[model samples]
Each structure stands twice: as structure tokens, then as C-alpha cells.
Target: MSLFNIFNVSASGMSAQSVRLNTTASNLANANSVASSAGETYRARQPVFAAEMAKANQGQVGTGVQIKGIVESDKPMLKEYMPDHPMADKEGFIYKPNVNVMEEMANMISASRSYQMNVQVADAAKSMLQQTLRIGKS
Candidate 1:
């Protein structure tokens, strides 16, 4: 792949990771929100990604990443017995999101690292191109 292609790939990766980070943050923010019913409870959202492929001269090459879609987890929501809670339903139950705080934190860290790595890759590519130009100047 060309150095310019590296920039495009890195940019796409960074964008995808940004979306992931945002969704993770949203999930964490709503993790504690209580609901009177399961239907009203927040569901943890996750970003789906696909590898973009290009038909190059040599077979096919990966171009970059693309967002497939955002999906909500199918895991069951948490049900708690809070008889006196304002949000309690007819059965004295309060529904909470199934979001696992620890899991979300891990995801946040991973997304952050992935984004950083993409930036480093772009920077490295830029440096390599600059060095190539300097060789021409000399």
C-alpha cells in the first residue's frame, strides 16, 4: 500500500474508534438510570465495524474500516425489588440497565488505545513521507 493510503486507513480507523468511544460513554452514563419497566430501561449499545476492501491491481487490499451499525445488547435487564422507590412498578420492582460498569470501562480503555495507535500510525506515515521529501531536497 502507498503511504497516502496509510493516512486514509488510519483516519478511518480513528473515526471508527471515536464512534466506539462515544457509544461506550453513553452506555456508562446511562448505566445507573432506573426504569419502571424493562421496555423503558436503557440498553447498552455497541458499534459494529467492517473492514473496507478495495479491488487493487493485486487481487484485493484492505482500504480502511467502516461502521456497519450500532446494536443493542440482548442481555436481560436487571430487576430489583424496591418497594418504596418512586420508580417502582406495580410489582414493587425497579428495572435497571444491564450495563456492566467494569466491562464498559475496559471497552473505553481499549477504544482509547486503538484511537491513539491510529494517530501514531498516521504520524509515522507523515514522518516517513517527509523524510522521503528531504532525501529529494538533498
Candidate 2:
């Protein structure tokens, strides 16, 4: 791949990491949310990423990534019994979002690191390009 292609690849990676971060943020925000019923309960969400084959291979210069979809967690919610809880149901049980805070925090950290790595990749590519241009000057 050409040096220029590195930017595209890194850009795609950054985009993917951004989606991951957003999902983690959403999960964290709803971590303490409660619902009276399963249907109304917030579910943890995650983004589904797929290779951008068309962008990566088109004209023999395929390198970009794309987001496929965002998926809701199928895991069951945590039911807590708190009679004093205002949001509790008739049984004094409240349904919390299925998201696990620790898992989401880990995901957030991973996404952040991935984003930083992509930025570093882009910066390195830029430096390489600059050095290549210097060769022309010489």
C-alpha cells in the first residue's frame, strides 16, 4: 500500500474506535438506569464493525473500514429488590440496564487506546510523507 493509504487505514480505525467509545459512553450513562419492565429497560449497546471491502479494494486501493450496525445486548438485566426505590415495581424490584460497568469501563479504555494508536499511525504516516518530500528538495 502507498504511504497515502496509511492515512485512510488509520482514519477508518479512528472511526471504528469512535463508535466503540460512543457505545461505551452510552452503556456507562445507562449503568444506573432502572426500568419498571423489561421492555422499557435500557439494554447495553455495541457497534458492529465490518471490513470496508469496497473502500479497501476499490481500484486496487482498499484500506478503509466501515461500521456495519449497532446491536443491543441480548443479556438479561439485573433485577434488584429495593422497596424504597422510587422506580421499583409492585414487587419492590427494579430492572437495571444489562450493562456491566466494569466491562464497559474496560471497553472504554480499550477504545481510547485504539483511538490513540490510530492517531499515532496517522502522525507517523504524515512524518513519513514529510520526509519523502524532503528527498525531492535535496
Candidate 3:
């Protein structure tokens, strides 16, 4: 692979990580949100990523990562009998989101680290290119 490919790969990684971080942040923000019914309750969301391939002279080569889509978790929502709650249903039951605070926090941390790593990779590639250009100079 060429040095230019490193920049593309790193950029894709950073974009994917950004989406993941945003999804995790949204999930965490709604972790404690309560709703009157199951349909109205928030569900944890996850970003789907896939390897992007490009047609090259040597058949196919991986270009970078791509975001396929975002999916909502199927985990059962937390149902609690809180009669005094303002958003309780007719049966005095309140519905909470299925989002797990701990899990979302961990995912956020991982995404953030991945983004930082990608940035480092791109920076390294840029420095290498600059040094290569200066090699022929006085």
C-alpha cells in the first residue's frame, strides 16, 4: 500500500469512530429517560461498520471503513411500578430506556481512543510525506 492510502484509511477510521462516539453519547444521555409506554421509550443505538474495498490493479484492496447503518438494541426495557411518577401509565407503571450506562460509557471511551489513534496515524503519514518532499531540496 502507498503512503497516500494511509491517509484515506485513517480518515475513514476517524469518521467511523466519530459516529460510534455520537451514538454512545446519545444512548448515555437517554439512559435515565422515562416514558409512558414502551413505544415511546428510548433504546440503545449502535453504529454498524463494514470494510470498504476498492478495485485496484491487483484485484481488490481494502480502502477503509464505512458506516453501514445504526441499529437499535432489542434488550427489554426496564419497567417499574412507580405510581407517583408523573409519566406513569394507566397501570402506574413507568418505562425506562434499555440503555446501560456502564456499557455506553465504556463504548464511548473506546471510540474516543480509536479516533485519537486514527489522528496519530494521519499525522504520521503527513510528516512522512513532508520529509520525502524535502529529500530532493538543497
Candidate 4:
């Protein structure tokens, strides 16, 4: 592995964490949304990440992370009886999304922290590389 590969690995991690943060934000935004039925209810979304291996480096892959896809939560939505609710069904019951605000907020914080950590790691690597360049300079 080359010294520059460190930047690539950290960049991939930061990109993956960004997608995670976006999904978490989306889930939190729709946490209070309501639907008359399950079909219309909003489900939480999560990003699936996978690591990419470097064939040239060795059998062991470098830290290259990629988003596989976004998956929706399978948990059931909450059903509430609100006859006056605008989105209520014929039976006067409204279906609220199963999203948990606290959980989503926690996920957001985690992603944010991970992103910051990656940025720090990249910055540290850059500083080290710059210092190395001064080794042979007058």
C-alpha cells in the first residue's frame, strides 16, 4: 500500500458516513408523518455499506467503503384512532410511522462523529505527508 492510499481509504469512509447521516436525517424528518394505511405509511431508511478490495495491493483489501443500497425498516407503523384527523381512515383510525425520534437522533450523532473522526484522520495524514516532503528540502 502506498502513503497516498491512506487518503483514499479515509475519503471512502467519510463518503459512506455522509450517506448514513443523510438517511438518518431523512428518517427523523418523517418520524411524525401519518398515513391512513400501512401502504402509505413512511418507513425508516438506512444505508447499506460495503467495502471494496484493492486487487493490486494484495488479497487483503484497502479501506474502500461503498454504499450498497438504502433499505426500509420492516417494523409496523403505529395505529391510532383520531376521527377528526385529516388522514384518518373510514374507521377513524390513522396510521403513524414507526420511526423513533430518539433513535434517529442518536444515529445522526453517531454518523456525525464518525464523519468528523475521518476528517481528522485525513487531515493528520495530510500533515504528515507535508512534513515528510520537507525532509530533503534546504
In terms of lDDT, the best-performing candidate is: 1
Q: Give the lowest summed-lDDT range of ten residues in model 1.
A: 53-62
True-structure lDDT of candidate 2: 0.90
The sequence of per-residue lDDT tens digits that candidate 4 reaches over residues 9-67 is: 89989999999999998888898888889899999898998777454356644567878
Error of 1 at 132 (Å): 0.4
lDDT of 1 by residue, 7-88 (tens): 8889999999999999999999999999999999999999999877444435545478889999999999999999999999
TM-score of each: 0.95, 0.92, 0.93, 0.92
Better candidate number, 1 or 2, judged by TM-score: 1
Better of 1 and 3 by lDDT: 1
Model 4 spans > 4 angstroms off: 54-61
Residue 120 shift from truth in candidate 2, angstroms: 0.8
Task: Report the number of backbone clashes for model 1.
Answer: 0
List the global CA lDDT of all models. 0.94, 0.90, 0.91, 0.87
Model 2, 5: alpha-carbon shift in Å?
Answer: 1.5
Cα distance off (Å), candidate 3, residue 58 = 6.8
